[model samples]
Target: MLVSTFHRCFVAVCILLLSACSTGYHGSFVERSFYQGDITGLNLLGPAQAEHCQSYALYLFPLKHSPSTQLAIKQAKRSQPNTVMLADISISDTTHWKIGYAKKCINVTADAYGKPPSTSNG
Candidate 1:
């Protein structure tokens, strides 16, 4: 009887620990965050998105270093080779934590723009 009771208690503890895992999200947006030169010649290609993540071992030491907006932006730019700037940008940060490990990620979504094809409408 005592062995059965101990097994039940262990199961309860495991359930509680698993239920304690949590996740959080934060988001921000900007009109233009990655451009500076002339804007009159740029054409909106389309929407683009990318994600960058960093994992923590033992909930302390980083495994893939820290996630950053810069890395996310770089990843996003890869989808479109002609993308020279981003507009209507949105950045979302997510964090998930458990008993043994944690993860942080950055998701970047933006409208990619670049120079249009040169043509003479004359």
Candidate 2:
């Protein structure tokens, strides 16, 4: 019984460690920018060339529009950091972007998916 329990514990520890390492932000520079009330224009950087800024902008749209429910805003306000480190993994090239006031920070990232539809195609 003791041996079995030890094995379980070891497995749990390994799983936890792997998860912890896998989960977290992987971005270059995270900055805070002014929100001009338009959530669509926020620029985000990532791996892909064209979609990086657009991806981040899309991610931040909800946060700018609905600041009340956003956890990042709350955390930023509570932490009172000029810039908070973000661990978002959905962004392309592992790059992330942010924009907001000192009290709030909106998270944005580059899209990891295929290139955004070209304008000419539309």
Candidate 3:
């Protein structure tokens, strides 16, 4: 009886580990303008990228709210405080699972542009 229980538990653990899966999604840009009106006067602030992730326990109970592209974009824009808008935006999603833990993420990548921060020379 003891040997049988041990064997079953070991198999269960192995199955749990093997059943975990991971997937990634390559999303395209949505039909939306980064900025309305003309952008001729905006200065390029180079590229910015950010990711927002949410965790799940047992794939059923969420540890937090689902990640969002808007949050990711906001995070990316934080890198440049003066950034007024983004351009050439792209979005993607990634999911990773291991045992009873899982994480899903929203990733945003874009070119940030806005008026440059003024430097005060002393």
lDDT of 2 at 79: 37
lDDT of 2 by residue, 5-120 (tens): 99999999988874563345343443432343543432333222212112324332332332222343334333322222222322222323345311222343322212223367
Candidate 3: RMSD over Cα atoms?
5.3
User: Can you tell me which runs of candidate 3 are displaced by over 4 Å?
Assistant: 1-26, 30-33
Against the hidden reference, what TM-scores do the models get?
0.66, 0.27, 0.70
Q: Supply candidate 1's per-residue lDDT for 4.
A: 100
Question: lDDT per residue, candidate 3, 1-122, as tens digits?
Answer: 99999999999997776455343356878533367757888888888789999998987578968888888989988877688888888898887777988888988888888899889999
Ranking by lDDT: 1, 3, 2
Residue pairs with clashing backbones, model 2: 25-87, 56-109
TM-score of 2: 0.27
Ordered list by TM-score, greatest first: 3, 1, 2
TM-score of 3: 0.70
| Clashes per candidate (backbone, < 3 Å) | 0, 2, 0
CA lDDT, candidate 3, residue 8: 100
Report the lDDT tens digits of candidate 1 across residue range 1-122: 99999999999997777445433356889887567788888888888899898888886578956788998988887777688888888999877776888787899999988875568999
